[model samples]
Target: MAGNGGHLTPGLVNTRTHLFQAGLRGIGEGLGLLAWLSAVGEEAARLTPERAYATAAAAAAEALRSGTTTLVEHMWPHPSSEVHDAVLRALKDSDVRAVLCRGVADRADPSRRWGFDPRLMQPLEAALAHTDELIAQARGSRVDVGVAVPNPRCLTPKGMGAVRAYAEGRATLARHGVGVSYNPLSNMRLGSGIAPVPEMLEAGLSVGLGVDRAASNDTQDILEALRIGAYLQRAVHRKADLFGFPEMFAMAAGGANRMLGIEENPDGGVRAGTRADLVLHRFDRDHACLPVRDPGATLLTCGSSRTVAAVLVGGEVLVRDGEHVRLPSREPAAGLARRGSCGG
Candidate 1:
């Protein structure tokens, strides 16, 4: 009977992506990272929570189809808690484990040089307060809240201090078990320099990965983030291979699981009893199999999300025939976009 059943595999983990920006897929259109953020941020204000939710759900479906089972979502709060709660309910409805990264903003950050007009950065207290509200709002929802500090470069010392304080506050509630995801490259691409990754890692924090907004990235691939992370450590120490490949894979795998803080322990590799999370490829047993003394090398260098065959979560086929089930409509966001770049 096990053989009679069609083969199923685990999904790829998309460490970071703004679900709302999936609409910006080709719309980025060559803008430099900073300019792109400016354009996209302005553009995103048009999205209603409903639209963002639908878009995010659709992205989840896409990930499942493209070999992503568990998605660690760094989503912005809705117009209200009810709206966010509804979104989480929808995530359960759609069948993907959602780890919502509740991010705090900092208006007083000096790195505002990255096309961040004074009008954009909301006051620190306002963001902190709202973030707290959102956390409470998300309570009891299928979605889990993981606190994310804006990269230090994205915030001034004062702003980062506030963010750190917020993280501390959340720790008291999530029982010091809350997870964290940061986007240093996004900060640096916007001329904000590296976030204090070393510091955060040292703070007894559950550090994880995320690419932030697509507008801030040249490429949205998780592999690129892996590569960037290694180079970043090297630049920090002027020593290449400082973190190394083993560390990078751990970041892509276990780091994401750590970010989710899933109840089931996560080794994140394709080992048995690890939630059946895996990505099956279309290799002819030669493409990725040949010269296979080093399978990890083949995947790290030549493996791509493109060869993904199916995405299974908890042994359920969320994706089959390369399509995610229960996708929602996105015409609203597109229609709103056509009307104006969010009247914000």
Candidate 2:
């Protein structure tokens, strides 16, 4: 394929997402975190295996379309193995590299103010066993399994010990080095305060961009996350020079690889020995991106999914000419919207 006057760069890695919430988009508008979760929980309670497949596929398709080659799906606890299996199938079918984090929460609260929603809570033993099962199922695929906990408050002392034991040598923050998933859009939408990204960088912490979930973010567009993440820091610090385009671009691409235990490219670019997870963005194709002065600055400021000419994951062309190679031409999210009445 011809470059066609496009810029080729490393594909984005979305550090955190709840893909099952794709069907629950636009549920809790204009509400804070606690109130929003209450509203979303009602929809979450109705999740089925079929719904999980459709929503996760739709979410993964959107992420791939927007140049996110990798995603970390942070699934909340569910008793049904079918639902988890459906998510894994969707991700594998989408051909996006993923870490499926099966969630566990022991402290259940009906009100969900201080603890996890009881409807989604399961026994820690069962959750750990299920995670192992998922890991086995994903052995030879692009998808991998990990454990997810909502927060420290959601776990009991014993539950914490079990979770720690489970994660002792696998995907632990201390072992792999700490990383932050900076989700600007979700934080803004939920009225969560801005993350101290500048401070995190100053402290030499690895930080990566994330869209959070379709429910809170309403879209899995990592380009928007990249732009907003940098703008927020600049506006708060009252310094236009806070985060440069190259630095923010790195964060959007491969900055959190260490956190996820994925090996980073030697120089973090299209080098001889690097992985072929790449994106080709055409500035000439988009009016907003035309007359590009600096490719990095223009991409950070004006690039959208529409400007992505192609996306390659592991040397496989998943998206060519801005369309997913395997997915149908019809919008994947359409199925979720049609089934919206199910949640209601």
Where does model 1 exceed 4 Å of error?
Answer: 1-15, 26-34, 76-90, 106-142, 146-207, 218-246, 256-260, 263-267, 270-274, 285-294, 328-344
Highest lDDT: give the candidate number.
2
Clashes of each: 5, 0
Per-residue accuracy of model 1 over 248-305 as CA lDDT, tens digit each: 5655566645435563333345666567665555433235434544545544444444
Candidate lDDT scores, in order, read 0.54, 0.85
Encode model 2's per-residue lDDT on 5-108: one tens digit a residue: 88998888999999988888788899888889888777777788888888899889889988999999999888778889999999999999998999899999
RMSD of 2: 1.7
Quantify how close model 1 is to the true structure by its C-alpha RMSD in Å: 6.0
